[model samples]
Target: MTQPQGALLVGSIAFDDAERTMRTAATELGGLLRRIPDGEVGPRFHWIMFQPDVLGQAEGIERVGEERIPLRMLDARPLRVADGVDPREIRFPELGYARAARESYALFRRLREEGVIAPGMRFQVSLPTPLAVVGAFFPPEQRAAIEPAYREAMSREVEEILAAVPHEDLAVQWDLAVEFQIIEELPGGVAAWWDGAWAGVVERAAWGVDLVPHDVEVGLHLCYGDVAEKHFVEPRDAGNLVRFANAIADAARRVPAWVHLPVPIERDDDAFFSPLADLRLPEETELYLGLVHREDGAEGAQRRIAAAQRVVPRFGVATECGIGRAPAGTTEGILRTHAEVAAPW
Candidate 1:
């Protein structure tokens, strides 16, 4: 297996300006990263929460909100299920991901020519899994019926991306916070709307791998839900992440090009990474451990690196989750921390 020598960005950079984000990432850490995101900017952080709006606009869905709870917890109904909505006949009124990615890649290409971004770095687009949308917006009973339509709509977004962007210069990542919610089944935590089974979640994610063309770089960001910049369930250890990642890798026909896992801020200890010893990834897959934290900086990253080395010989570094929702003014320091702990590619 090829060992990673640098850091990876888990998308959603804080920079609201797409062009500026690309410039900074390329000039500062281009060598360290093979992929760069469009920086889930402006409305994206909260856009997924408003997916009910999109579903409501669709022909066969109804958006109904809970009167008692906060406005974010929407309960979308599949009118088509009651009205015989064929999954193939269903189509979303809008596909946001494709539109955003196309806009960003234009900036990335311009930067590459301007000598800011290096040649051949793929544009990374992180997408919430269709299951995540189904789980977050619809009520438990409606999820099973709603998922097929949502998945088909999500597939259309991917299709549009592939048509617009070059396969060689594109990377698609399935952001997977909701899967962890299912895996852990936390008390009072967000519950999975599907048949709450570990294997089912893994299978769905692997099927997502199949959604992307094999030639396009495919990756998975295994995460605990990162709402308000905090994990829904802080991982007690890497065991669940290890188990889930291996399942996706095993089930995926086209092995993932990379898989990222989180590490708790305080877990710079052997016990946290011991499960990594059982991790079975394909030789070409890169493993990125999210161990770098702003609080500990370089010294803390070194501690996590040391602990991780005891179980797995080598891996790359990243922050535990996207830095966009983090406190303002901390993004640059966090980016620099990755540089401090690991060398550039």
Candidate 2:
């Protein structure tokens, strides 16, 4: 079960909530995670995990800040569930959430200092993207203003996280579910907004990147909704590829970091990657392809791995999205299957 050289696998524990509790994440995917590479024993691996202490609840508008703080004093607005306010805007006390991030950073620092990771391991820390914060509250029309707000907030968050982790040992991944926020909107508005926001993030990162120590890994995990209902976030249509391509290309060119993406889940469209491969990205930027489907069985997984090998050689293996919604046992099978399929390649 030891990982072979250049063995590609999914990143670490993905949780269902923003708080990123480890036990919660472990319970959600531990069985399978424990089984992979003979229960976490194998291969030069890539892991994705959340810093729990840094998180607030995804519930009521104000999930940020210390749990001890009263919501009313913290800018948290009260509303009836039926009142129709968007769920994310309920802000918690800014100071509390900010402190929480600091405390969480300590925990991550401690774990690293204690050598929680094995030798030769590279890990990626994931946080909610700036767009995620704003989109969670605003409607399509209001989303335009979120970019500026998120940029300032996110830039600070990124800077703090980079300071906390060892620059050389780990990588950072900004989870961008918000980029797909306007999937249901007219393509023109959605595309324009995302393009602008993507640019803003890159600009913010210019300073944020320097905060990380030299040689620290930085990446962007771009996926549409991983939830069961929302399925694919962007249009899978022929014309839709152009916009997506632009977004990916722009992010790559601007950020110059690894870009991990989910495979197109709705159809068997290998061609969807045609635009991606052609993107003007650095040769050093790695592409982690989500080759194994959460719902795929042994046969389906084999097909997926084989198909992907045809396009990219240095590609890594991962799930289409986090397995938070799936039963832990099912997710375990996926991890194991990914190892099996990639063993020969």
What is every candidate's alpha-carbon RMSD to the true fold? Answer: 3.3, 8.8
Candidate 1 lDDT? 0.81
lDDT of each: 0.81, 0.45
Q: On residues 1-345, what C-alpha lDDT tens digit does candidate 2 reach at each position?
A: 222112233333333322243333233333222111111111101111121112233233233344443322232321121245453453322312234334544544444365542333444455555445544533455456434544555566566655655555456655555455444353433343445554554443343333444576666555665545244455453233334434554544244355556665444456555544444446766556665676665466556555555554455556665554455556456546655544332
TM-score, structure 2 vs. true: 0.61
**Mind giving the per-residue lDDT tens digits that candidate 1 earns over 1-345?**
233377888988888788878887877787898899877876575536556655677776654643323343433332333356654566776658888898988998888788887788899999999888877766676777678778888998999999989999999999988878878888865566546488789889998999998899999998886667677878889999999988888898898999999988889788889999999999989999998887888888888888888898878999888887777898888888887777677
Find the candidate with the highest TM-score and give its number.
Answer: 1
For model 1 the TM-score comes to 0.91
The candidate 1 region of ten consecutive residues with least summed lDDT is: 73-82
